[model samples]
Target: MIDNSVRTLFLLKHSPYPPMGGAPLRNWQNIKAMMQLGEVAVFSVSSYKSPRSREYPPGVSLWKDYSTGDILKERSLIRKISDRLWWMRLYGYPEADQFYGDRVAQELQRLLVEFAPNIVVFEEIWLYRYLKIIKPYGCCLIYDAHNIEKSLRRDISVSEHKPPFVSSLSGIKTAIIEGYLVQQVDQIWVCSQQEAHLLQKLYRQIPPTHIVANGVNIADYHSDRISHSLPTDGLEPNHFTAIFTATFSYYPNSVAAQILIGQIYPQLRKFYPNCRLILAGHSPTPYMKESAQEDSGIIVTGKASDIRPYLTAASVVIVPLLKGGGTRLKILEAFAAHRPVVSTTKGAEGLNVRDGEHLLIRDKVEDIVAGVCQLWSDSSLGRKLAESAYKLVQQEYSSTAVRQQVEQAVLQLLPSDFRF
Candidate 1:
C-alpha cells in the first residue's frame, strides 16, 4: 500500500544554493522531485548569493543560509587551525564553517524529536556529523556523495597543487577519518563508477554502492535563446567556434584552460584559420582574459546570466579538463544541446561515452587540432556527432533516471512503518 501522508525529509550540504557543478544541480533537482512525494526541509549553506538561490519549488521548505564572511576571513594561524580541527571533527576535513554551532546542534536534536522524518539525505559528507542526531530518530539516511571525496581529494593532490596532500600527520589523520565516514552511511549515492570503485577499495569489502550519474536539465538549457542583456563583446556564430564553460577558478578548469590556450589552440588555429575558442565562465583570471585579446581566435567571456546562448551558438563544445572526479556536467550540458564534443580522454572519463562514436577523443595537441579540423571541414560529421551526443543523454542520463534512483535509495533506507 502507498501512503500519501506528507513525510518530511531533511537535506544537508557543505555549500550553499543555485548549484553550479554536479553536486548542487543534483541537490536542486532532487529537492524539486522529492516535493512530489511529500514535504521536504533542505538544510544547506552557501557563501555567496544570486537571484537563483531564492527560487525554490512551491512546497519545498528550506533551512539554508549564506556562508559566513567572518568564517572566511579568519587568517590567524592558531584560530584557523583550531577552526579546521573543529570543522574536520564535523566531517573528516573541515569545511569553511560548521552548520550547527553549539546551539544549532542542540536545536536539530530538539527538532528531530518534534517533526520526525521518514528520511534524511545529507548532501555532502561533511554533514555526516549530524548522523547521531538523525539515526536515533529512526529515519533513513541517504548520503548523496557528489563524488567519492577521499579519492577525489587524492586525485586532486597529484593532478595539480590545488588539493595538495595534507603532509605527514594531517594527511594520515584525514584519510583515517574520511574512510570511517563512508562506512557509516546507510546507502551511498555516488556519481560515477570510477569514484565508487575507489571508495569500495578503500573501505568496503561487500555490498555494492549505487552509481547515480549527474543529469542535465534539458528544459532550461534550451536552444535559439540569445541574451540581449549580454554586452556581446563582438561574438559571432559564423566563425568556427569552440566553447567550454565552468567555474574557471577550479583547479582542473584552470589547468585545462592553461593547456588549451597555451598549447592546443595555437595548433588548432594554424590548420583552421577561422576557428575561435571561447572560455565562458565566472571569474576568469587576468591570464585567461588576455588570451582573447592576444588571439582573435580565443574569446574569454567572464560569467553569463544564461550560458545557453554561447552553447547554442557554438559549432563545438570542448572539454579539455585533465583532472577531477565524477561526470563532467559541463559535457552533459553540451551533449543535451546536441553540440559535438572534443575532449581529452581524462575529461570524458566517466559519463559512459565512446571514443570516436559519441565523442572525438584526443590526448595530444596535434590530434586535438586534427579532431577540430575534421569537425570544421565536415558539416555532416559535426551534425552526426551532435545528434549522437543528444541521443546518448536522452537514453541514459535523463532526469527520470536520477529521480527514480533517489526514490529507491530513500525507500531502502526508511523504516518499513514510515509513510511517504
Candidate 2:
C-alpha cells in the first residue's frame, strides 16, 4: 500500500554500497538520513560491490544496474572501447572506470520510467550520462557535487607521474565538461562550504549549493575502546602521541603521510624526543608498508579493521593533508572521540571549525612543531582543546543538526507539504 501523503525521492549514485571510499560513505549515510525524512527510491551502479552487501533503508526503494559485475574486472573489447568514450566526458580522457559504462545509466533509465520519483538526487556528476533519460520527468534535481570534480583531478594530476602535457590536457578537458555539468542540476549539496564554494568559484554560475558537513555517530565510535598492537619496541615511551587517520590508497592521505613521516614527525621528535606518530588506515600501499617497517618513531598499522583503538590511544590527532577537497571525516572522528587535533589549513579545510578553539591549524612545519609542542607540554591545554573539540562536534556537526538542514532542503524540493 503506497502512502499518498509521503513524497518519493530518487537518490542515485555511482555505487550502491558504502565503506569503500569517502564520497560513497557520505552518500550512503545521507541516503539513510534522508529516508527518515521521506520515502526514497535509490538507483545506483553496483559494479563495485556485491549487491547482497548493499543495505537499503526500509522506506527507501532501490534500483541498481546488473550490467557489469565488478568494476575491478577485465572487460570485453567493444565494451572497453565504449567505456573509454564515456570516460573522456568528465575525466577528459581514458582511465580504468572509463573503459566500462557505469551500469547506473541503464538502471537509472529503468527506475525513472517505472518509479517516477518526485525529486531526483544525484551523488555525483559522473552519473550525468543517465540524466538524458530522467530529465524530462520535471522533478526537482539535487546534484551533490562531492567536489569540484575538475579541481580534484587537477590536484591529483600534480602528484601523478604522467607526462606534463598529458596532465594539462586532462585537466583542461575535465574542467570544460564539469563546468557544463554544474549548470544542469537544480541544486547542489557538498560535504563542506570549502567544497561548495570551490565549485561556485569555479563555474561562477552554479545552482544554489548547501554545505552539509559529514556528521559522526558518536555512539558507534565510542562503542569500541582503543588498543595497541605495537610490541613495546624501546621507542614506545614517547611523551607526545599523535595519530593520523588515512589509507595509503588516496593521494591526499598518502601525500600527507609523506610529509608527516618524512618531514613533520622528524621535526617534532627534536622537541619531544619520545614523540610517537601513529598512522592507521585501510590498505597500506607497498611504499607505506616499507616505510612502516623502518626503525623511525612512526608506527604504521597497514589496515586496521577498527580505528577506534588507534584514535583512543592517541593524545593528539593530526590531519596534515597537503591537498584535496571535501570535509575531513577523520578530524570529526578525532573530535568526537575526544582527541585534540593539529591540522594544516587544508587538513581542516571544511566545516565550521574554528582555529585554536575547535582544533589547531598550522601551515608551516615550524608552526606545526610549535602547535604540537604547545599542546603536548601542557596537559591542561591539551585537555581543554580536547573538550572544546568534542563540544564543537556536538554543537554543529551533530547528526540532529545536520539532519535538520537536510530535511529542510528535501522539504523545499517537494512540490507540496507531504509526509512519509
Candidate 3:
C-alpha cells in the first residue's frame, strides 16, 4: 500500500533517534508514520552529538544531522553576535533562527534539488524559518505543532514571574511568527482538539488543522515486557513509591520537581512514613540534586537509559505540573505500565481522561497527596484506575491508533487520484 511516488522530507529542530524526551519522541513517531506513506529523509539539528548508530527504518535516510556545536564552531565572533542581535530584534528570542543561516539554507536548497520531495514536514514552528527554502521546490508543506508556542511562552513567563512588558513582547512576537507559519503550511497538525480550537481562535486564515494526539508504543510499557531493575541507588520493596517522570530540564517539569520535593512529598511522608518519591528524568536542576542529597526518601535519577523500570517499580505515578501545553505522554506511559496516576489539571490537559475514572486529577498539593495515599491504602481502587487507563490508552493513545490518525491526515494532502 506504500506510495512509491511520494518523497517526504522532515525538517526537525532536534534529532529524533533514541527518543528520550517528549519532542524527540513525537518526532520519532511522526517519522515512523511518514515512512508508511512514502520514502522519508530527515534533516535535523540537535544540541547533543549524533548517535554512532541510529536504528532508523530500512528505507529512511538521515540526510543531514547537525549539532548546535557543529553549527556554532564555524561562525566567527562578529557573525555570531550579529546573528543573535538580528534574531533578538525581530523575534525576541534566538531559537527560531538558530537552525537558519546561509550555510544551512544552501545545504537545504541542495537537498530540495536532489531529494525533490513531494511533501516537506516541519517538525515544529521553530523550523518554519526554513519554509522559504522549500517553497520554491513546490512541495506540500505540513507544520506539526508540538505546542501552541505563544500561549505556552506566555503562561511559562507569567508563572516564572517574568516582567510583564518582556513577557508581552515575547508573546506578541511568537504569535506573529506562529500565525504566519500556520497560514503558509498546506496542512497543520496539533496534539489535541483543544490546541486545534486555540489555533482557530488565534488566527483567522489558517489552513486545514488536524488533531494528531500524542501516544506511546503500548508494547514498550507493557508490564510483562518491562524488567524491574530500578536504576536508582536507594530503594526497598516495602516502600510506597510515588514517581514523576519527565525531561526535567523543561520549565514545567522543573517547577513540578521542586513542588514534589519541597511541598507534596513532605506532606505525604507525614501521613505514610514509609513513602518514597522518585523524580526520574534527564537534566535535574542543581536544586533538585541538592534536595535529593538532603532527603533519603527522595531519589533523583539524572538520566536513565530506559524509564520503563522506574514505572514498573512505582506504587503510583504523580504529575504536579503547574503550567504546560499539550497532552502529557508521561500519564499515558504510566497507564501503559499499569500504574495508577494522580495528575494536576494542567498536567493532564488535552487528554480525554476523566478524573477518578482513568486517573485521579488533583490541583492542590494537599489533594494530590491525599490521592496518592488513597491509591496506597486501597489496592483495588488503584487496580481499577490502572485497568481503565490501560483500556483507554489501547483504544485511543496507542501507537497503532495514532498511526491511523497520521495516515488519514497525510492522505488528505495527496492528490484526489492518489491512493494509499
Candidate that scores best on TM-score: 3
Clashing pairs in 1: 15-45, 16-45, 16-46, 46-67
Q: What TM-score would each prediction reach against the true structure?
A: 0.85, 0.84, 0.93
Best by lDDT: 3
lDDT of 3 by residue, 311-371 (tens): 8778899999999785488898899999999999999989999998999999999999999
Query: Which residue runs of candidate 1 sit more than 4 Å off their true CA positions?
Result: 1-17, 48-59, 70-81, 84-92, 96-100, 103-115, 162-174, 206-208, 224-231, 416-420
Candidates' RMSD to native: 3.8, 4.0, 2.5
lDDT, candidate 1, 1-420, per-residue tens: 756354555555434344555456677667765776677776654443322356554566645443434335534576567676753453344442443343445667666655566667777655655676677777656667776666665556676544333433344544665665566656777887777777778776623467777886666655544445333566765548888887776677888888889987888767776778888877687889888888777888786656777777688887887667654888888888778889988888877888777889988777887887888889888888878888888877788877776667666655566565
Give the Cα-based TM-score of candidate 1 against the true structure.
0.85
Against the reference, the lDDT scores of all candidates come to: 0.68, 0.70, 0.83
Question: Which of candidates 2 and 3 reaches a greater lDDT?
Answer: 3
The lDDT, on a scale of 0 to 1, for candidate 1 is 0.68
lDDT of candidate model 3 versus the reference = 0.83
Order the candidates by TM-score, highest first. Answer: 3, 1, 2
Off by over 4 Å in 2: 1-21, 46-60, 63-79, 82-92, 95-104, 113-115, 223-239
